[model samples]
Target: MGRRPVHVVGRVIVGLLALALTGCAAPAAPADSALSLGSTAAAAPVALTASATAAARTAKIYSIRTTDATKGVITVIGTLSPAPKTGTRIPLHQWIPSARRWQEVAHGYSSGTSVTIKTVQPGSVRTYRIAVGPQAPYAAAISPMISFKHYVWRGIFKKGLLATGGNATPQFNIVPPKEGPRRAEADLLADKGGYVWGEVNSTGCSFVRNWLGNLTDGTVRTSLHNGRRR
Candidate 1:
Protein backbone atom coordinates (compact mmCIF):
# COMPACT_ATOMS: atom_id res chain seq x y z
CA MET A 1 0.00 0.00 0.00
CA GLY A 2 1.17 3.55 -0.71
CA ARG A 3 2.81 5.42 2.19
CA ARG A 4 0.13 6.64 4.57
CA PRO A 5 -0.48 10.33 3.70
CA VAL A 6 0.73 12.86 6.37
CA HIS A 7 -2.56 14.80 5.76
CA VAL A 8 -4.57 11.80 7.08
CA VAL A 9 -2.84 12.10 10.51
CA GLY A 10 -3.37 15.88 10.45
CA ARG A 11 -7.09 15.49 9.63
CA VAL A 12 -7.54 13.00 12.50
CA ILE A 13 -5.85 15.42 14.95
CA VAL A 14 -8.08 18.33 13.77
CA GLY A 15 -11.28 16.29 14.19
CA LEU A 16 -10.28 15.26 17.73
CA LEU A 17 -9.48 18.89 18.66
CA ALA A 18 -12.89 20.03 17.30
CA LEU A 19 -14.69 17.39 19.30
CA ALA A 20 -12.81 18.39 22.52
CA LEU A 21 -13.68 22.08 21.96
CA THR A 22 -17.38 21.23 21.45
CA GLY A 23 -17.43 19.14 24.65
CA CYS A 24 -15.78 21.92 26.72
CA ALA A 25 -18.54 24.40 25.84
CA ALA A 26 -21.48 24.49 28.27
CA PRO A 27 -24.48 22.35 27.26
CA ALA A 28 -27.64 24.08 26.09
CA ALA A 29 -30.31 24.48 28.84
CA PRO A 30 -34.10 24.78 28.71
CA ALA A 31 -35.60 28.23 28.65
CA ASP A 32 -37.06 27.76 32.15
CA SER A 33 -33.93 26.20 33.57
CA ALA A 34 -33.03 27.21 37.15
CA LEU A 35 -29.42 26.05 37.13
CA SER A 36 -27.91 29.48 36.63
CA LEU A 37 -25.04 30.27 39.05
CA GLY A 38 -25.11 34.06 38.59
CA SER A 39 -26.73 36.09 41.38
CA THR A 40 -29.11 37.75 38.90
CA ALA A 41 -30.31 34.38 37.67
CA ALA A 42 -30.46 32.67 41.08
CA ALA A 43 -33.74 31.24 42.37
CA ALA A 44 -35.70 33.61 44.60
CA PRO A 45 -36.47 32.38 48.08
CA VAL A 46 -40.10 31.52 48.79
CA ALA A 47 -41.44 33.83 51.44
CA LEU A 48 -44.76 33.78 53.31
CA THR A 49 -46.27 37.08 52.34
CA ALA A 50 -48.05 39.13 54.98
CA SER A 51 -51.35 38.77 53.12
CA ALA A 52 -51.03 34.99 52.96
CA THR A 53 -50.16 34.85 56.63
CA ALA A 54 -53.11 37.05 57.46
CA ALA A 55 -55.48 34.87 55.47
CA ALA A 56 -54.25 31.85 57.34
CA ARG A 57 -54.73 33.64 60.61
CA THR A 58 -58.26 34.57 59.60
CA ALA A 59 -59.33 30.92 59.38
CA LYS A 60 -62.99 30.60 60.34
CA ILE A 61 -63.77 29.25 63.81
CA TYR A 62 -66.26 26.49 64.55
CA SER A 63 -67.10 24.92 67.90
CA ILE A 64 -67.65 21.25 68.68
CA ARG A 65 -70.00 20.82 71.60
CA THR A 66 -70.35 17.23 72.67
CA THR A 67 -72.42 16.06 75.59
CA ASP A 68 -71.26 12.51 74.92
CA ALA A 69 -68.96 11.29 77.65
CA THR A 70 -67.01 8.90 75.51
CA LYS A 71 -65.80 11.03 72.59
CA GLY A 72 -66.08 14.42 70.89
CA VAL A 73 -65.61 15.70 67.34
CA ILE A 74 -64.90 19.15 65.88
CA THR A 75 -65.18 20.61 62.38
CA VAL A 76 -62.97 23.51 61.23
CA ILE A 77 -63.68 25.72 58.20
CA GLY A 78 -61.21 28.03 56.43
CA THR A 79 -60.13 29.39 53.06
CA LEU A 80 -56.77 29.95 51.35
CA SER A 81 -55.89 32.51 48.71
CA PRO A 82 -53.39 32.17 45.85
CA ALA A 83 -52.77 28.63 47.05
CA PRO A 84 -49.75 27.81 49.24
CA LYS A 85 -46.33 28.10 47.75
CA THR A 86 -44.10 25.11 47.15
CA GLY A 87 -42.22 23.66 50.13
CA THR A 88 -45.06 25.02 52.28
CA ARG A 89 -47.66 22.69 53.77
CA ILE A 90 -50.62 23.06 56.12
CA PRO A 91 -50.22 21.59 59.60
CA LEU A 92 -52.78 20.41 62.14
CA HIS A 93 -52.00 20.20 65.84
CA GLN A 94 -53.88 19.50 69.03
CA TRP A 95 -53.23 20.85 72.51
CA ILE A 96 -51.94 18.22 74.92
CA PRO A 97 -52.53 18.83 78.61
CA SER A 98 -50.19 16.10 79.79
CA ALA A 99 -47.28 17.36 77.76
CA ARG A 100 -48.36 20.99 78.25
CA ARG A 101 -47.50 21.51 74.60
CA TRP A 102 -49.00 21.42 71.14
CA GLN A 103 -48.51 18.19 69.18
CA GLU A 104 -48.75 17.65 65.44
CA VAL A 105 -51.78 15.61 64.40
CA ALA A 106 -51.86 15.83 60.59
CA HIS A 107 -50.28 17.66 57.67
CA GLY A 108 -51.39 18.23 54.04
CA TYR A 109 -50.78 20.40 51.06
CA SER A 110 -52.56 23.74 50.77
CA SER A 111 -53.85 22.91 47.31
CA GLY A 112 -57.53 23.25 48.11
CA THR A 113 -58.99 26.66 48.75
CA SER A 114 -60.64 25.42 51.92
CA VAL A 115 -59.48 23.05 54.67
CA THR A 116 -61.49 21.04 57.11
CA ILE A 117 -60.49 18.77 60.01
CA LYS A 118 -62.82 16.08 61.25
CA THR A 119 -62.93 14.09 64.49
CA VAL A 120 -59.76 15.34 66.16
CA GLN A 121 -59.76 13.58 69.56
CA PRO A 122 -56.10 13.22 70.40
CA GLY A 123 -56.61 15.32 73.53
CA SER A 124 -59.33 16.05 76.04
CA VAL A 125 -59.28 19.63 74.80
CA ARG A 126 -57.75 20.05 71.38
CA THR A 127 -56.69 23.34 69.83
CA TYR A 128 -56.03 23.55 66.08
CA ARG A 129 -53.26 25.67 64.57
CA ILE A 130 -51.80 26.07 61.08
CA ALA A 131 -48.48 27.08 59.60
CA VAL A 132 -48.57 29.29 56.50
CA GLY A 133 -44.85 29.61 56.29
CA PRO A 134 -41.98 27.26 57.05
CA GLN A 135 -42.65 28.27 60.66
CA ALA A 136 -46.03 28.36 62.40
CA PRO A 137 -47.73 31.74 62.15
CA TYR A 138 -51.45 31.15 62.68
CA ALA A 139 -53.46 29.35 65.33
CA ALA A 140 -57.10 28.33 65.11
CA ALA A 141 -59.47 28.74 68.01
CA ILE A 142 -58.95 26.39 70.92
CA SER A 143 -61.69 23.80 70.58
CA PRO A 144 -63.98 23.28 73.51
CA MET A 145 -62.66 20.58 75.77
CA ILE A 146 -64.47 17.31 75.05
CA SER A 147 -65.23 15.96 78.47
CA PHE A 148 -64.82 12.15 78.72
CA LYS A 149 -66.10 10.09 81.61
CA HIS A 150 -66.57 6.34 81.98
CA TYR A 151 -69.83 5.80 83.81
CA VAL A 152 -69.49 2.21 84.86
CA TRP A 153 -71.42 0.38 87.60
CA ARG A 154 -70.23 -2.96 88.91
CA GLY A 155 -71.67 -5.25 91.65
CA ILE A 156 -70.06 -8.14 93.38
CA PHE A 157 -71.52 -10.26 96.19
CA LYS A 158 -69.50 -10.10 99.40
CA LYS A 159 -67.35 -13.28 99.59
CA GLY A 160 -69.25 -14.53 102.66
CA LEU A 161 -72.72 -13.36 101.53
CA LEU A 162 -72.53 -15.19 98.19
CA ALA A 163 -72.76 -18.60 99.93
CA THR A 164 -75.32 -17.61 102.60
CA GLY A 165 -78.52 -15.50 102.52
CA GLY A 166 -76.64 -12.97 104.64
CA ASN A 167 -77.92 -9.50 105.64
CA ALA A 168 -75.50 -8.03 103.08
CA THR A 169 -77.27 -6.57 100.02
CA PRO A 170 -76.02 -5.56 96.56
CA GLN A 171 -76.39 -1.82 95.83
CA PHE A 172 -75.82 0.60 92.95
CA ASN A 173 -75.12 4.30 93.40
CA ILE A 174 -74.65 7.64 91.64
CA VAL A 175 -72.57 10.71 92.26
CA PRO A 176 -73.75 14.12 93.59
CA PRO A 177 -75.92 12.15 96.06
CA LYS A 178 -79.54 11.35 95.28
CA GLU A 179 -82.44 9.19 96.55
CA GLY A 180 -82.02 5.54 97.62
CA PRO A 181 -81.04 3.74 100.87
CA ARG A 182 -81.77 6.39 103.53
CA ARG A 183 -81.57 4.91 107.05
CA ALA A 184 -79.21 2.04 106.28
CA GLU A 185 -75.71 2.97 107.40
CA ALA A 186 -74.48 2.12 103.87
CA ASP A 187 -77.15 4.29 102.27
CA LEU A 188 -76.63 7.18 104.71
CA LEU A 189 -72.89 7.16 104.20
CA ALA A 190 -73.20 7.10 100.43
CA ASP A 191 -75.96 9.78 100.44
CA LYS A 192 -74.49 12.42 102.72
CA GLY A 193 -71.22 11.75 101.00
CA GLY A 194 -70.60 11.97 97.26
CA TYR A 195 -72.15 8.61 96.25
CA VAL A 196 -75.65 7.10 95.88
CA TRP A 197 -76.54 3.57 96.87
CA GLY A 198 -79.07 0.92 95.74
CA GLU A 199 -80.81 -1.85 97.75
CA VAL A 200 -78.78 -4.96 98.52
CA ASN A 201 -80.64 -8.28 98.45
CA SER A 202 -77.50 -10.33 97.97
CA THR A 203 -74.38 -10.52 100.14
CA GLY A 204 -72.74 -7.41 98.54
CA CYS A 205 -73.52 -4.67 96.08
CA SER A 206 -71.50 -1.88 94.41
CA PHE A 207 -72.10 0.85 91.84
CA VAL A 208 -70.20 3.57 89.94
CA ARG A 209 -71.27 7.01 88.66
CA ASN A 210 -69.41 9.29 86.32
CA TRP A 211 -69.74 12.82 84.96
CA LEU A 212 -67.64 15.53 83.33
CA GLY A 213 -66.10 18.16 85.53
CA ASN A 214 -64.67 21.58 84.86
CA LEU A 215 -61.14 21.74 83.49
CA THR A 216 -59.90 24.01 86.27
CA ASP A 217 -59.99 21.30 88.91
CA GLY A 218 -61.36 17.83 88.33
CA THR A 219 -61.14 14.76 90.48
CA VAL A 220 -62.64 11.29 90.73
CA ARG A 221 -62.59 9.14 93.81
CA THR A 222 -63.50 5.47 94.20
CA SER A 223 -65.34 4.19 97.27
CA LEU A 224 -64.05 1.60 99.70
CA HIS A 225 -65.61 -1.85 99.88
CA ASN A 226 -66.94 -1.49 103.43
CA GLY A 227 -69.21 1.40 104.27
CA ARG A 228 -67.90 3.87 106.84
CA ARG A 229 -70.51 4.36 109.55
CA ARG A 230 -69.13 7.79 110.42
Candidate 2:
Protein backbone atom coordinates (compact mmCIF):
# COMPACT_ATOMS: atom_id res chain seq x y z
CA MET A 1 0.00 0.00 0.00
CA GLY A 2 2.91 2.40 0.70
CA ARG A 3 4.54 1.59 -2.65
CA ARG A 4 2.91 4.47 -4.49
CA PRO A 5 3.75 7.02 -1.75
CA VAL A 6 0.48 8.69 -2.77
CA HIS A 7 0.72 12.36 -3.70
CA VAL A 8 -1.73 13.52 -1.03
CA VAL A 9 -0.59 17.15 -1.39
CA GLY A 10 -1.55 17.21 -5.12
CA ARG A 11 -5.03 15.79 -4.33
CA VAL A 12 -5.64 18.46 -1.63
CA ILE A 13 -4.67 21.26 -4.05
CA VAL A 14 -7.05 19.89 -6.70
CA GLY A 15 -9.89 19.69 -4.20
CA LEU A 16 -9.41 23.32 -3.12
CA LEU A 17 -9.26 24.49 -6.75
CA ALA A 18 -12.57 22.70 -7.49
CA LEU A 19 -14.22 24.36 -4.47
CA ALA A 20 -13.02 27.79 -5.56
CA LEU A 21 -14.37 27.27 -9.09
CA THR A 22 -17.71 26.16 -7.70
CA GLY A 23 -18.07 29.32 -5.63
CA CYS A 24 -17.29 31.47 -8.69
CA ALA A 25 -20.02 29.73 -10.74
CA ALA A 26 -22.79 30.52 -8.20
CA PRO A 27 -25.50 33.05 -9.26
CA ALA A 28 -26.02 36.42 -7.54
CA ALA A 29 -29.03 37.11 -5.32
CA PRO A 30 -32.01 39.02 -6.76
CA ALA A 31 -32.78 42.61 -5.90
CA ASP A 32 -35.73 43.63 -3.75
CA SER A 33 -38.98 44.90 -5.34
CA ALA A 34 -39.28 48.64 -5.86
CA LEU A 35 -42.83 48.80 -4.58
CA SER A 36 -43.11 49.33 -0.84
CA LEU A 37 -46.26 49.29 1.25
CA GLY A 38 -45.84 52.78 2.59
CA SER A 39 -45.06 54.24 -0.82
CA THR A 40 -47.68 56.30 -2.70
CA ALA A 41 -48.32 58.51 -5.75
CA ALA A 42 -49.07 62.25 -6.06
CA ALA A 43 -52.27 63.17 -4.27
CA ALA A 44 -55.29 64.90 -5.71
CA PRO A 45 -56.84 68.03 -4.21
CA VAL A 46 -59.71 67.78 -1.73
CA ALA A 47 -62.15 70.37 -0.46
CA LEU A 48 -61.09 72.28 2.63
CA THR A 49 -62.83 74.49 5.12
CA ALA A 50 -63.57 78.04 4.04
CA SER A 51 -60.78 79.28 6.30
CA ALA A 52 -58.27 77.11 4.45
CA THR A 53 -59.19 78.09 0.88
CA ALA A 54 -56.04 80.03 0.19
CA ALA A 55 -53.76 77.37 1.59
CA ALA A 56 -55.78 74.56 0.09
CA ARG A 57 -55.29 75.90 -3.40
CA THR A 58 -51.55 76.18 -2.98
CA ALA A 59 -51.01 73.50 -0.33
CA LYS A 60 -52.96 70.34 0.46
CA ILE A 61 -54.82 70.03 3.75
CA TYR A 62 -54.41 66.87 5.72
CA SER A 63 -55.58 67.24 9.31
CA ILE A 64 -55.97 69.89 11.99
CA ARG A 65 -56.50 69.89 15.73
CA THR A 66 -56.21 72.02 18.83
CA THR A 67 -54.28 70.67 21.81
CA ASP A 68 -53.31 71.58 25.34
CA ALA A 69 -49.97 73.30 25.24
CA THR A 70 -48.80 71.87 28.56
CA LYS A 71 -49.97 68.28 28.23
CA GLY A 72 -49.94 67.83 24.42
CA VAL A 73 -53.49 66.47 24.28
CA ILE A 74 -55.99 67.04 21.51
CA THR A 75 -59.00 69.27 22.17
CA VAL A 76 -60.31 69.91 18.66
CA ILE A 77 -60.55 67.52 15.73
CA GLY A 78 -60.50 67.92 11.90
CA THR A 79 -60.04 65.35 9.19
CA LEU A 80 -59.64 65.10 5.40
CA SER A 81 -60.94 62.38 3.07
CA PRO A 82 -59.33 61.53 -0.24
CA ALA A 83 -61.06 60.00 -3.26
CA PRO A 84 -61.56 56.26 -3.05
CA LYS A 85 -58.69 54.24 -4.38
CA THR A 86 -56.88 50.98 -3.68
CA GLY A 87 -53.30 50.49 -2.55
CA THR A 88 -52.90 54.20 -1.96
CA ARG A 89 -50.93 55.81 0.83
CA ILE A 90 -51.42 59.38 1.89
CA PRO A 91 -48.82 61.37 3.77
CA LEU A 92 -49.26 64.52 5.77
CA HIS A 93 -46.71 67.26 5.45
CA GLN A 94 -46.32 70.80 6.73
CA TRP A 95 -44.91 73.87 5.15
CA ILE A 96 -41.85 75.16 6.94
CA PRO A 97 -41.80 78.84 6.20
CA SER A 98 -38.36 79.25 7.69
CA ALA A 99 -36.91 76.68 5.30
CA ARG A 100 -39.35 77.45 2.46
CA ARG A 101 -39.87 73.70 2.17
CA TRP A 102 -42.61 71.11 2.73
CA GLN A 103 -41.79 68.45 5.28
CA GLU A 104 -43.58 65.14 5.88
CA VAL A 105 -45.13 64.95 9.34
CA ALA A 106 -47.11 61.68 9.21
CA HIS A 107 -48.31 59.00 6.81
CA GLY A 108 -50.81 56.12 6.57
CA TYR A 109 -52.87 54.14 4.11
CA SER A 110 -56.08 55.86 2.91
CA SER A 111 -58.70 53.12 3.11
CA GLY A 112 -61.34 55.39 1.59
CA THR A 113 -61.95 56.47 5.12
CA SER A 114 -60.87 59.34 7.32
CA VAL A 115 -57.98 58.86 9.70
CA THR A 116 -57.83 61.29 12.56
CA ILE A 117 -54.57 62.76 13.85
CA LYS A 118 -54.75 63.67 17.50
CA THR A 119 -52.79 65.33 20.29
CA VAL A 120 -51.41 68.09 18.09
CA GLN A 121 -49.94 71.40 19.18
CA PRO A 122 -52.42 73.79 20.76
CA GLY A 123 -53.26 77.01 18.90
CA SER A 124 -51.11 75.56 16.17
CA VAL A 125 -52.42 75.25 12.61
CA ARG A 126 -51.33 72.24 10.50
CA THR A 127 -51.93 70.81 7.00
CA TYR A 128 -52.25 67.25 5.54
CA ARG A 129 -52.80 65.55 2.18
CA ILE A 130 -52.77 62.17 0.44
CA ALA A 131 -50.47 60.51 -2.12
CA VAL A 132 -51.85 57.96 -4.57
CA GLY A 133 -50.52 55.61 -7.25
CA PRO A 134 -47.13 53.85 -7.35
CA GLN A 135 -44.85 56.84 -7.07
CA ALA A 136 -44.69 58.81 -3.81
CA PRO A 137 -46.91 61.86 -3.83
CA TYR A 138 -46.32 65.32 -2.44
CA ALA A 139 -49.59 65.29 -0.54
CA ALA A 140 -49.68 67.90 2.20
CA ALA A 141 -51.81 70.47 3.90
CA ILE A 142 -50.73 74.06 4.22
CA SER A 143 -51.90 75.01 7.68
CA PRO A 144 -52.94 78.59 7.82
CA MET A 145 -49.88 80.45 9.07
CA ILE A 146 -49.75 81.36 12.75
CA SER A 147 -48.82 84.87 13.79
CA PHE A 148 -46.25 85.50 16.51
CA LYS A 149 -45.26 88.99 17.58
CA HIS A 150 -42.07 89.94 19.37
CA TYR A 151 -40.54 93.38 19.96
CA VAL A 152 -37.05 94.45 18.97
CA TRP A 153 -35.12 97.61 19.85
CA ARG A 154 -34.54 99.72 16.80
CA GLY A 155 -31.65 101.80 18.15
CA ILE A 156 -27.92 102.07 17.51
CA PHE A 157 -24.95 102.67 19.79
CA LYS A 158 -21.16 103.04 19.59
CA LYS A 159 -19.30 99.74 19.81
CA GLY A 160 -16.06 100.73 21.51
CA LEU A 161 -14.89 103.04 24.36
CA LEU A 162 -15.34 106.79 24.09
CA ALA A 163 -11.68 107.37 23.16
CA THR A 164 -11.57 105.13 20.08
CA GLY A 165 -13.56 106.30 17.08
CA GLY A 166 -15.41 102.98 17.13
CA ASN A 167 -18.09 102.25 14.63
CA ALA A 168 -21.75 102.45 15.50
CA THR A 169 -23.07 99.15 16.88
CA PRO A 170 -26.61 98.34 16.04
CA GLN A 171 -28.59 96.79 18.91
CA PHE A 172 -31.99 95.21 19.30
CA ASN A 173 -34.27 94.11 22.13
CA ILE A 174 -37.03 91.53 21.62
CA VAL A 175 -40.30 91.90 23.51
CA PRO A 176 -43.60 90.06 23.32
CA PRO A 177 -46.47 91.82 21.65
CA LYS A 178 -50.18 91.67 22.44
CA GLU A 179 -52.41 89.25 20.57
CA GLY A 180 -55.19 90.64 18.46
CA PRO A 181 -58.69 89.21 18.11
CA ARG A 182 -59.17 86.63 15.36
CA ARG A 183 -60.46 88.03 12.11
CA ALA A 184 -63.10 86.63 9.76
CA GLU A 185 -60.87 86.60 6.70
CA ALA A 186 -58.83 83.56 5.68
CA ASP A 187 -55.66 85.63 5.69
CA LEU A 188 -54.97 87.42 8.94
CA LEU A 189 -53.00 90.63 9.10
CA ALA A 190 -50.55 90.63 11.98
CA ASP A 191 -47.62 92.90 12.88
CA LYS A 192 -44.23 91.49 13.84
CA GLY A 193 -41.31 93.60 15.14
CA GLY A 194 -38.34 91.21 15.30
CA TYR A 195 -37.86 91.01 11.54
CA VAL A 196 -36.52 94.54 11.37
CA TRP A 197 -33.81 93.58 13.82
CA GLY A 198 -33.01 90.48 11.80
CA GLU A 199 -32.68 92.64 8.74
CA VAL A 200 -30.41 95.04 10.60
CA ASN A 201 -28.14 92.22 11.68
CA SER A 202 -27.94 90.87 8.16
CA THR A 203 -26.89 94.27 6.78
CA GLY A 204 -23.70 93.07 5.10
CA CYS A 205 -25.31 90.01 3.53
CA SER A 206 -27.42 89.70 0.40
CA PHE A 207 -30.46 91.93 0.54
CA VAL A 208 -32.59 89.23 -1.13
CA ARG A 209 -31.91 86.72 1.65
CA ASN A 210 -32.96 89.09 4.38
CA TRP A 211 -35.97 90.26 2.46
CA LEU A 212 -37.12 86.70 1.68
CA GLY A 213 -36.81 85.59 5.27
CA ASN A 214 -38.73 88.53 6.57
CA LEU A 215 -41.35 88.17 3.91
CA THR A 216 -41.81 84.45 4.52
CA ASP A 217 -41.97 84.88 8.26
CA GLY A 218 -44.58 87.55 7.90
CA THR A 219 -46.58 85.37 5.55
CA VAL A 220 -46.44 82.46 7.97
CA ARG A 221 -47.62 84.60 10.83
CA THR A 222 -50.54 85.73 8.77
CA SER A 223 -51.42 82.17 7.75
CA LEU A 224 -51.21 80.87 11.30
CA HIS A 225 -53.34 83.69 12.51
CA ASN A 226 -55.98 82.89 9.92
CA GLY A 227 -55.82 79.15 10.59
CA ARG A 228 -56.43 79.61 14.30
CA ARG A 229 -59.53 81.63 13.66
CA ARG A 230 -61.03 78.71 11.74
Q: Highest TM-score, which number?
A: 1
lDDT by residue (tens digit), candidate 2, 33-73: 22332232212223333335443212233434434433334
Q: Rate residue 58 of model 2 by lDDT.
A: 26
Stretch of 10 with least lDDT, candidate 2: 180-189
> At residue 107, what lDDT does model 1 achieve?
56
Candidate 1's residue-wise lDDT over 20-129, tens digit each? 98786546453434444545444233233554556433433233333332333444444454344443455556566889987776654544555554443422434555
Off by over 4 Å in 2: 1-63, 67-69, 73-87, 119-230
- TM-scores for every candidate against the unseen true structure: 0.29, 0.26
Evaluated at residue 177, the lDDT of candidate 2 is 25
**Sequence-dependent TM-score of model 2:** 0.26
Task: State, as a TM-score between 0 and 1, how close model 1 is to the true structure.
Answer: 0.29
Model 1 error, position 172 (Å): 7.0
